[model samples]
Target: MDTQVIVLSVVADIVGLVSVILGFVAEKTKIKPSEIIVNDFVYCDYPTSSVLGMAISASLMLILAEVLIAIAGSCCGCCRTNAAGTGKSVVGIVLSVFSWFAFTTSFILFLVGAVNRGVNWQHLKIGDDCPLSSHLPGIFAGAAVLAFVAVSLGTAAAFLLAATPGSSSQYAQGVEMGRPQFQVPSNGTPPFNRPTI
Candidate 1:
C-alpha cells in the first residue's frame, strides 16, 4: 500500500509538471503562426486571444498546483510512522504532487496554444486592440519551466527514499528455513526408564 501510494504520488507529480512546462512553452514561443490579413483593415490593439486564454488557464493551474502541494504536504504526513519519516514522506508527496500539477499545467497550456485546440490566433492580428501584451506568453512559458524543475526533482527524491529497503518490507523479511531444536531427546536410557514420544 505504501509503495502504491508513493508511485501514484510520483506519477501525479510528473503529470502536473509536464502540464506546467507545456503551458510555459505555449506562452513563450509562437508555435502557431499569426494569421495574415489580405487587405489593410481597421485593426484594433488587443492581446493575442489564444495567449490570453492560455495565460488565464495557466494561472488557474498554478493556483491549483499550490493548493495541491499544500494538501499533499499535509495529507502525506498521515502515511508516515516517525517524525523524520513523516517529514521525508511529506516532502516526497508534496514534490510528486507539485510535479504532476506543473506537468499538467504545461501540457494544458501547450494544448491551448495549439491553433485549433485553444483560442484562435487568426482572429487576433498584429497591432490590434487587445488587452494583454504580446510578450505574456513567453513569461508564462518560463514560469511553467520552473514549475517542471521543482516538481520533477522533488518527486524523484521522495520516490527514491520511498523505494529504499527497510526491515519491515516483505522482501527484507523472508521465511525462516532452519529447523527448531529440542532441549532434550525423547528417548532416555540413562535414568533407568526410557521414554519415547
Candidate 2:
C-alpha cells in the first residue's frame, strides 16, 4: 500500500474514533426523565446537558476529516482528469459522494437529537406529553456508526483517486487522448514470417 494511503487511513481512523466517542458521550449525557420537571409545560434543568456540544462537535469533526483527507490525497496532481483515469475517478467520486451523503445524514441526526436537549421554553404543552422531546439513545449511537462508515468510505475513495494513472507522480498514458499505446519493434524483418524458396 502507498504511504499516502496509510497516512490518510490513520488520520481518518483517529477522526472517526473521536467522533464516535463524542456521539456515545452525547447519548450518555442526554436529558433523562428524572431531570425533567412536569406540571403543564416541560423544560430542561438549569445549565442543561452537555449533549448539545458533543453532538455538534462530532458533526464538525466528521466534516473536517473528510475535507482534510480529500485535500491531502490528491493535491499533487493525483486526481488529474484523463481518459486513463476515467473509470477509477468515477468509482472514487461515487464512493466519496456516498460518504459525504452518509455523514450529512449523521450530522442532521446529531443536530436534531441535540437541538432539544437544552429547551428552556416552558410554554409548550406538546399535546399532553410531558417529555416535550423524546430522543432515543439509538439515534446518537446510529449516527456515530454512520460517521465511522463515512470516514472509511472517504478514505477508500481517496486511495482510489491516488491510484489513478496519468498523475504527474504516476505513469502517464501518453499524449494520445491519454491512452496507452503498444508498438512492436521493427528490424526490417517480420516477427513470424519466413522467406520460402
Which candidate comes out best when scored by lDDT? Answer: 2
lDDT of 2: 0.71
Candidate 2 lDDT, 45-143, residue by residue in tens: 323677878888998888777776676456422355552447776787788788888888888888888775664534444555544345565789889
In candidate 2, the residue pairs with backbone N, CA or C atoms under 3 Å apart (3 or more residues apart, or in different chains) clash, namely none
| Candidate number of the best TM-score | 2
Model 2 misplaced regions, further than 4 Å: 39-47, 75-87, 119-123, 126-128, 134-137, 168-197
In candidate 1, how many clashes are counted?
40
Candidate 1 scores a C-alpha RMSD against the true structure in Å of 12.3
Candidate 1 residue runs with Cα over 4 Å from true position: 28-44, 59-79, 85-137, 160-197
- The worst-scoring run of ten residues by lDDT in candidate 1 lies at 164-173
Residue-wise C-alpha lDDT for candidate 1, range 70-152, written one tens digit per residue: 34333433333342344555466556566556555554544444433343333343464332343334555656775666555
In candidate 1, how many Å is residue 125 off? 16
For residue 155, give model 1's deviation from the true position in Å. Answer: 1.0
